[model samples]
Target: MRTIRIPYAELPANARAAVEAHTGPALKADSASEGLNSEIAVRLVSRTGEYYVKGRRASHRWAWTQRREAEVNPFIRGIAPALIARVESAGWDLLIFEAVDGHHADYRPGSPDLPKVVDVIRRLGQLPCPTIELRHAEQRLERYVDRPEDVAYFAGDTLLHTDWNNTNVLVAGDRALVVDWGWATKGAPWLDAAFWVIWLIASGHEPASAEQWAAQVPAWQGATVEGIDAFAVANAHMWDEIGGHDPDSWTARMVDAARRWRDHRKA
Candidate 1:
């Protein structure tokens, strides 16, 4: 794959100044891919200490994403990385956070951490959030749906991560911390739960084991087979909008898995 380079010089003057101010002269900086957002990582060296910097070029609505996270970070401390500072200037938003230590979890099917991953997500769903309204399949469908009733049956009320994939989670010291809160919103918690379920199964877990893991989460406990089916459909539609590699294949697999689960339940 060709390396994509960002036009860092195009950043507004204030944003550039902020970057320089945080990382004094003789600092090493590198850009990292953050999927939906324009992101860069800077490594600073100073007499005081060394720290990592993350800067994201913001859209008009970019500040809200970080600000909202700032509000929630304290409450969910330990479950996510600590938020250090956020800078908003001239159509750009920069956020400095404590660098999470550890590599991304290898999320193939039947990975040892799959159950733990499900548990962490369920815990996130249960966290107290007074301000943000969680979104469900219906809301996501409305925003990204191409056809009516495309996501009709999957709607529910729960705080959802919206995007739950292997790349977004960091595993450190036997704990799984979810990162990239940019897509988080209030909605059916199961939407996020189901999203991960499909991921786990596709990564290579047997259907029975994946279903067992899914059932352990309160958000998915007692969830009918049909409910999971609807979630699969809605999730596939949402994934299409994100346009990842081999989306068609992944979507087909999710659909097939959902159908198989439904058929097994009927039998």
Candidate 2:
């Protein structure tokens, strides 16, 4: 479920003051309507410049995600927005990013944004995993797999942006920038490609077409048949529990797409 949005004006006075110290007085606080993670997501315009701010209460259980995103920003320089500042004040933790001038990538079939997105994935795959604290893919998915041993297939030293939701990818003229690093993981090089396959399927691509797109990523070409099968099965089961059988929810829709791909791989 998405976090309930908190209006910018409602943030504690000290927190607001601390943010303004970096951004100057915000002339406008255009609250963002997309994304599930932040309690406060807004685009701010100030005399100084423009910035994108996302925050959670310091006491919130997920506040560490703000720190996680900040910690990973330096390593993913060209592929993501730069983190300009991070503020922890008066019970709030906020991340201020250089406002990217782009729109979300369209994942539908025939969309021109697809190639740029693949390019982003290609560039991302070339970087080594940073020595930061990141969740390992095998550990994160262990409970979802049929057998614990299957988790080994996902272990590797590559950095992964595991979420491929369309909203998380921004497409400018010829580049696609990935955002929301809170869920960044260390995993097999092919895992991010596999993750993208699910979103492509959800976006109306047939299973075969989606896998073809995944193949465009160099790491994906090395995926083993058994490894792909394990991932498909594990992801399907993961979404089943996350969606709770609610047919109308996005996760339920993902559940269907994942199962379709899993069955296709088996056949």
Candidate 3:
């Protein structure tokens, strides 16, 4: 793959200076896009620890998103990776985080740590963020909801980890930590729960087991099981929009789960 390099001159002076100070010989780096931001990773050696310095070439919109997470992350420490430092250089924003120590959840499924994965989602829901309104999964669904038939059905909100794929979750020891907060938005908590259900099933759990686990997620004081089911359906539909590559059997299973949840909601 071709890689682009960020010149030191293009970064903020403080950030450039910090990178130079830490990375003795000005190590080679690569630029890649992770979701919406231009991301760059450079190797750096420092007295604090060996680290991969990462920055997102800031766009007007994503800059605020990055800054919001940087602001909110410090308060939600145990739930996220530790923030090492922030670097502002030449119109660019860089976030240096304590490198998490584990592979993405995709690599370690059969290790009996699945429940902890569910636990992290539930715990994040329980956190009280009065200022941060959760992004509704319904809004995300509406982006792909092309028909009036779909519109009336997806008219609610929940806290959603817009990207709940296995790749974004990291498993360490007995715990599962969710990373890549760029997509974290408030909506129906069930939207996140439902998406995770699909993820768990795609990762090889039975549909019944996935649904059972999802159903057991404790209500976060203001959410409901019915709301979760709606979120699940919307989540599945959104996944289909994004061209999810799950096998037909997996998609069928998700459809079945959505139907069952919908029927239960109606009853």
Leading candidate by lDDT? 2
Candidate 2 colliding pairs: none
After superposition, candidate 3 runs with Cα above 4 Å error: 1-15, 20-38, 42-44, 60-64, 106-109, 144-160, 220-229, 244-267
Give the higher-TM-score candidate: 2 or 3.
2
lDDT of each: 0.61, 0.92, 0.57
C-alpha displacement of 27 in model 2, angstroms?
0.3
Residue 99 Cα positional deviation in candidate 1, in Å, after optimal superposition:
0.7
Q: lDDT by residue for model 1 over 29-125, one digit each (tens)?
A: 4455544343555544444445545555465445466666655566667668887667677666777666666767666764777666776887887
Judge candidate 2 against the unseen true structure and give its global Cα lDDT, from 0 to 1.
0.92
TM-score ranking from best to worst? 2, 1, 3
lDDT of 2 at 240: 80
Q: How many angstroms is residue 2 displaced in model 1 relative to the true structure, after the best TM-score fit?
A: 13
Write down the lDDT that model 1 would get.
0.61
What lDDT score is found at residue 216 in candidate 3? 63
Please provide, for model 3 over 125-173, each residue's C-alpha lDDT reduced to its tens digit, 9 standing for 90 to 100: 7776535644444565666544535534434443345567665677887
Better of 1 and 2 by lDDT: 2
lDDT of 1 at 194: 66
